[model samples]
Target: MNDSDAINKYHLSVERADGQTDNLVVSEGHQQPEDVASTRLERVNLRNGGNVDYQEFALEQEMILKARGASKILQVCVMLPLEGAYSMITPEGEECHFTPNQGFMFRYIGEEVTFTLPGHQTVRSLGFCVSLDVFKRYLDNQIPDTIKPMLQPKEIGSLPVPFQIDNFMRETLDRNLQVEAQGSLKQIRWEGTALLCMALVEEKLHKAANPETFSLTQACKQKAEAALELLMADMQDPPCLADLAQELSITEKKLNLIFKSLYGDTVFEYLRSIRLNKAKNLIEQTNMAMKEIAWTVGYNHSTNFSKAFTRQFNITPANFAKKARKLTKVS
Candidate 1:
């Protein structure tokens, strides 16, 4: 099969939020027998044989809704609340919420959940599911068998991990809901959306499992790399911390933090190291005098440069040049 076909076949199976919104409909139809307000849940199908959903629903009054009947499936879920204050109580008495700007994910199986939503509030939430097997694959099954069950908290003990929903995820969810692809492209679009969400879900799950893991987001990394490029471009006259941070639209303190995390050195120290390394290269590769080499690498005086070179490389600049010359002759 072609690549597109293979990808489509995977069919991300992006399930709607546990409670149907958009065009999704629950098994019991419009209102549960215990109904107090209007509700609509519909399972939408993509044209290319893939299933994706876009649901927007609301409770007309202040009332409790039983999420659904007990199920026999183990699943991982992700949800984002678009508007209003959404609240739910899991079967285990865990009172939970999904507010604006926050992402929520949890694991459960065949258990009922209750929505304790506010009155006259419309709930627009997007959620998707990843099977346990698929989730384990992404995590390399390193999840100890002992802790597998604990991945989803026991009844009354769901340790739901709350994280900030990044821009990429928010935009993707919005586009997936609004996108209307044509012909053969619809399934691929659906699958792509599903695949991206799965990746995001896996990443969040990894963080959830490893609480100590520090995620260096894309935005911060880009800024740090840009700063490095600027410093490398002109080692003889590197930018000062304040100026460099301003160019990168970051605080000087944040720039240093990024450098320390990525390179194990502060901005000043990193710049010094760069100058010393450049000086060593020029010393070995050129016939420049010690003072010239020092100037070339941003040091004002040969004595200062020699001190730093010795500290960094355990050899004086003159001695390094002599050793480099001897090596060239021997070769």
Candidate 2:
């Protein structure tokens, strides 16, 4: 599909740091953003490049983003949600939740890719996109080859692929975020960052797709990180180890090893740490009751929840909430 078929794209008006305006269609295949009042954005900027467009923004809301009807254009998108998690319901009705450090790749095939943000946390997201025309030249070596599989146009409703955003990319994004370049210099810096990310992501995905005899590749660690997202997707009733292993096409023992080697914990222990961290945020930020917080984070009983919370943080949930509320009142 050509540019004409790529209608329904969102037009993000951009003003460079040097104070000039640009009207570029950065994201395609999704309709113009609707229900705008319900969402809030602190800042958003789009920068056009030779073959890629970089978009950076911070979002604070909890809403299901809508999509348009099916079309022919296939847009491969890379999104890194640095501070929060989002759920994407694929067009075929499969749902996947992507949390921080769990970057995702998907071919936006002219359908709705719903992203819902919970926990009422503010997250900064960095996104990069190359149009189909630009993406199709992998055989000609336009974009990095690692992205070829990810950029491959798929049938409608293909499953979203998850990847781990490693420490290098994280630190690179940090430095890129701090750059104060103006005009064309700004474009050079960010677009370079975009391609640099492309190389790293490609290498990571290549490892994940082709794992030899139980080796410890960055890609292996990346797949483990992806598993973490799926494991915690439904804290209430998550999939079992067998199921997760089947999804990754590895044995249960190997899956546990990946988690152990990369994260230094068994799956259960890692999950406990994550659950308690989420609960701590809830106690400090939201007004939800102890039982509600407990259940939300997968605890079945408040007594057990209080015990675990105290064990994790050295303070009971009730007292923690009370102290947090008191501090709120004081401030």
Best-fitting candidate, scored by TM-score: 2
lDDT of 2 at 231: 75
lDDT of 2: 0.61
Cα error, residue 208 of model 2, in Å, equals 1.7
lDDT of 1 by residue, 1-331 (tens): 5432222221111122344332112431122222323444433333333233434545444545455422434555566654445676766777777664466666655455766555444555665544566556545777643235635543534446565554456556666756777656765665566567656655655644654324567888899889989988887788888999999898887777777678866787777788889888887788899899898888887777875675466455776788897887788
RMSD of each: 22.3, 13.0
TM-score of each: 0.46, 0.51
- Regions of model 1 farther than 4 Å from truth: 1-40, 44-54, 58-60, 138-159, 182-187, 204-331
Flag clash pairs in model 2. Answer: none
| Whole-model Cα lDDT of every candidate shown, in order | 0.59, 0.61
Clashes of each: 12, 0
For model 2, the superposed segments whose C-alpha errors exceed 4 Å read 1-8, 11-61, 67-72, 136-156, 211-331
